[model samples]
Target: MINEIQHTAETKMQKSLDVLRDNLAKVRTGRAHTGLLDQVEVEYYGSMVSVSQVASITLLDARTIGVKPFESKMAAVIEKAIRNSNLGLNPAAMGDLIRVPMPMLTEERRKDLIKVVRGEVEDGRVVVRNVRRDANNDLKRLLKDKEISEDEARRGEEGIQKLTDKYIAEIDKMLATKEADLMAI
Candidate 1:
């Protein structure tokens, strides 16, 4: 039972790390990547769909993202969607391809992004700590119910703490990398 609790707690911690990774990916730097437009939605037929569904996104260069729509007519709609999205991108249509260039980040913008990254790191840490708390609570409950020995509960809590520390270290590493990316010219 103690092993089961540790395994579940570790799994939850890993998932929290993944969520932090996806959230960090959304915080773009000056460099261009296909993930930047992952959230842009366009009207396809009668339903709204992601830009990636109706168009193929590629990195044209370090600073430019190339989006090619499958159908020629969808170029206009895709361009409009990218423009209207809150990514602060400007997509210019040159024939069938839409060129979305990533603007250079100013000092103020970089600082703002750093602040956002810090907030995300803090949130990640909180989630990991919460998982630890839940696991410890479960351990206590098991001990009180006479299901797990006191020593087993103590060991389980220690294991959960170690997992929390490991995940928090990973989160801190991610923050450092992101901060460096943001600060880069």
Candidate 2:
């Protein structure tokens, strides 16, 4: 039972880390990355679809993303989707291809992004801590029900704490890397 609780807690912590990773991927850093457009959805045949579905996104250079629509007619739609994606990007349709250049981050913008990153990091920490709290509560409940001994509950709580600390450190590391990327010129 204690092992089961630990396993569930560890799994939840890992999921929290993954959420932080996905969030960081969306925070662009004046560099061209295909993941930046991962959230863009384009209208296709009366249905909305991911931009990557109707087109191919590639890095044209360090600062430019090149998107080539599979169908020539989709070029205009793809351009419009990117322009309205709220990513502050402008896509120029060059025949069948749409070129999206990553704009340089101004100092104020970088600081703002840093603040966003910090908020994400705090949220990640909270998720991990919440998982730890749940696990601890479960341990206490088990002890109350005579399903676990006092020593067993103590051990389970310790294991949950360790998992929380490990994942929180991972989240902090991700935030540091993202901040570095944003601060880079």
> How many clashes show up per model?
0, 0
Q: Flag regions of model 2 displaced more than 4 Å.
A: none
**lDDT for each candidate structure:** 0.94, 0.92
Q: Which candidate gets the maximum lDDT versus the true structure?
A: 1
For all predicted structures, in order, the TM-scores are 0.98, 0.97
Error of 2 at 134 (Å): 0.5
Residue 33 C-alpha lDDT in model 2: 97
* lDDT value for model 1: 0.94
What does candidate 2's lDDT look like per residue over 1-185, in tens digits?
99999999999899989988998888889999999999999999999999999989999999999999999999988899899999999989887878999888999999999999999889999999999999999999999999999999998998888888889888888988999999999
Give a tens-digit lDDT track for model 1, residues 18-87. 9999999999899999999999999989999999999899999999999999999999999999999989
Model 2 residue pairs with clashes: none
